[model samples]
Target: MNLLFVADPLSSFSVKKDSTLAMMLEAQAKGYAIWHCHIEDIKSVAGAIYAKSQKIKIDMAGSPWYVSTQTKEMKVAAFDAVIMRKDPPFDMSYVTATWFLSQAKLEGAKIFNDPVALRNHSEKLSLLEFLQYAPPTLISYDLKDIQDFHREHQDIIIKPLDGMGGMGIFRVKSDALNLASIVETLGDSGKRALMAQKFLPEISEGDKRVLVIGGKAVPHGLARIPQGGEVRGNLAAGGKGVACPISEKEAKVAEHIGPLLASRGLHLIGLDFIGGYLTEINVTSPTCFVEITQQTGYDVAKQWLTSLEQYLK
Candidate 1:
């Protein structure tokens, strides 16, 4: 099988933790051809989508880790599968890339986490669709409205709508120190929107990342526990990741939501849960494959590829 990964530059990959790299390694082990490209390399010409991509070999022990055997322009449909593994700031550029990928789908390209689904689901805000399992949340650009939410909740977490890896997340306590400042910074003086959720003290335990693959939740989840004085439990924010069995509640929620998202073409999803409440629906580039596998002895990447194979069949 031929697989094309539309991702960031290969130079940026961390071999130790990058889930895309893990997938590539697994695909290579399975004797599948692998190609790589950045979103910018995708283009539309004469109503057909093409990518200026490189057929690459991954060598874990090598200094550079990858060798580009061939670089050529190929129709998006030529590949058996196209994996959208780009990380997000989810700006206009990302949106435009998805538009092209969506067009590619029409041209017979099979893309995972379908381009249209990527465009439709906001990682932080999509949780509103399943609010029965979510905390009290508010998404707004108005500082007053956010402040009112803070006042009502007494403790809250505010973050940018497009932030990832826990960037731009702030925890405001009941005292509300720096509340206005945080509101202005995140909201950009009402020029940009932000999300505010009633703080879940269970964060002190950990922020559990429940991976839903092939319409089922992985039995074990990686709990990213905050270190020191950190309020964010994201691994990028200096947290420790510990893999553990998912709770019954988590399994139930995953069983319910996983198939729905899979039916929408999101073959893989990362559902963030804090204090047993659904927090975010991470559709774009959901990770933790390496950590979960290394810690729990569960091959998440293998499971993902198995699911992909079944999906294609």
Candidate 2:
């Protein structure tokens, strides 16, 4: 099988923890041909999607992770599967890339996480669909509305619509002197919209990442604990990763959401939780494959590939 990965440049990948790299290595070990392409590499030629793609060889144990063997402009249907592993800020370019991939999807190439679903699902606002499982949340551009939420909740977390890795996330307390400033900055003086959630003190315990693959929950979830004075438990924000057995509640949540999401073309998803409340639904580039595997002895990437093989069959 020939598998194409539409993602960032190979040189930019962090081999130690990148889930896409892990999946690629697993596919290589299984003797599949590996192809690489950047989002910009994709183009529409006479209304058909084509990519300036490269056939690549990888050495995970080596200093340089990948070496391109050859490059060519190929139709998207040339590959058996296309893994859309592009990381997110969910900007205009990302949306345009998805539109390109959607053309490939229509032309009979399998695309992971379904380009159509990715466009429909906003990682932050997607939680609204399951509001019963989430904390009190508000998406607004008005500073007055946000301030009212903060006053009602006493503590809240505010973030921009497209932020990831905890960037642009702020925790505001009722007594915080800069609460109004935070709202202004995140809301961009009422021009840019932001999401605000009632702060769950359970965040102090940990922010759990529950990975669901092929409509089933992985038995273990990675609990990222905030470090020092940081309020964000994102690994990029200096949080410590600890593998925790999935709680019954979390497992139920994953089981309920996983298949539904998979049916929409999101076979792999990362559901974030603080306490028992669902925080965010990450469909674009959900991570923590290595961290959980190292701690819990579960080869998540291998399992994912095994499932993918079954899915393809």
Candidate 3:
């Protein structure tokens, strides 16, 4: 099957840790026609969405890496499926790209983790819909709301509503100096929303990252425990990854959201939980397959592409 992946610059991928890169490499190994493009390369001309892209081949186990390039104008429909693998700052351009992809979908390209559903859900806000399974979360820009949360939860964590990879996330466990000022300075009021939740003590065990592919749980994943003095449990944020098993609580989280999201076009997703409470439902830029592969010696890219092939069938 032919697949197009929209991502960052071609040379920026670290297939060692990036699941998207690993997936592309795996697909190329299987003789699937793999193509790559960036969001900036996507454009609309006369009501058609096109990209300046190149077909690439990768060897996940090799150093020189695999190679193939066909720099040409490509349409989304030319591929069997479009994998939107770009990373996030989730700015205006990202939303606009999703809008363009939805148009491409209407014209007959199959998009995984649905473009329209992604633009609507935006990861963080979507989890609020299943609040019962999640910790006490507050979406507010109001300083008073944050202050009140600090007063009640006493130990509260504040994160940007659009945050990913644990960026711009902070813990306010004490009445530290300028706590109120920091809250206002970090998370804007009225204009944007910040997620304030009761800080969980179990975070030291590392947060659990569960990858859902084709509406089912992938076998291996990691428990990313935060280092001492760190509240954010992201690998990039100094969190250590330990090969850990998923608990019944993590499975329940997947069971509840998997079918619903898959039906909505979110065929692949990464759901984050810490100490068994739901945190984020990562629809856009869901990662962890690389770590999972390293831990269990299975190629998740093969699993994902196989699912795409079945869907195309």
Candidate 4:
């Protein structure tokens, strides 16, 4: 099988924890041809989509990790599967790339986490669809509305709508110190929108990343625990990751949302939870494969590839 991975520059991959790299290594072990490309390498010409991609080999024991064997510009449909694994700020450029990918999909290219779904689902705001499992949340650009929410909740977490890895998150207590400034900065003085949720004190336990693949929950979740005075439990925010069995609450929510999301073409998803409340729906590049596998002895990459094979079949 031929697989094309549309992702960031290979130089930027941290093989130790990169989920895409893990997928590539697994695909290689299975004797499948693998190609790599940046989203910028994609182009539309004469109504056909093509990517200037490189056929590469992943060397797990090597320092460089990957070696490019050949470069070719191939039609998007030529590959058996096109995996969109680009990390994001989800800006206009990313949106435009999805549009191009969507065009490719229309032309018979099989893309995971459907381009249209990725474009439509806001990682932070998509939680509204399943609010029964989420905390009281508010998404608004008006400082007054946000302030009202803060006042009502007493303790809240406010953040920009497009932030990732726990960036631009502020925890405001009842004292409301610098609340106005935080709202102004995150909301761009009412021009941009922000998301505010009633703070879940369960964050002191950890923020769990529950991965669902092929409409089923992976039995274990990697809990990213905040370290020393940190409010964010994201690994990028210097938190520690510990893998543990998913609680019954986490399991129930995953079972309910998994197939629903997979039917929409999001075959892989990372559902974030703080105390039993669903916090975020990570569709665009859901990770933690390496951490989960290393700690739990569960081969996440293998499971992912198995799901992909079944999907392709």
In candidate 1, list every pair of residues with a backbone clash. Answer: none
lDDT rank order: 1, 4, 2, 3
Q: What's the C-alpha lDDT at position 229 in model 2?
A: 82
**TM-score of predicted structure 4:** 0.99
lDDT of 1 at 9: 94
The per-residue C-alpha lDDT of model 3 at residue 26 equals 72
Using all chains and alpha carbons, the TM-scores for the candidates as numbered come to 0.98, 0.98, 0.95, 0.99
**In lDDT terms, which candidate is top?**
1
What clash count does candidate 3 reach? 3
* Candidate closer to the true structure by TM-score (higher is better), 2 or 3: 2
lDDT score of model 1?
0.93
Q: On TM-score, who's better, 1 or 3? A: 1
lDDT of 1 by residue, 1-313 (tens): 9999999999999888999999999999999999999989999988999999999999998989999999999999899999999999898889999999999999889999899999999998888899999999999888889889988999999999999999999999999999999989777788889999999989988999999998989999999999998999999999999999999999999999999999998999999998799999999999899999999899999899999999899
* Model 3 pairs in collision: 114-265, 206-224, 206-225
For residues 1-313, write the lDDT of model 4, one tens digit per residue: 9999999999999878999999998999999999999999999989999999999988878778878899999999889999999998898878988999999999999998789999989998889999999999999988889889988999999999889999999999999999999999777788899999999999989999999998889998999999999999999999899999999999999999999999999989999999989999999999999999999999999989999999998
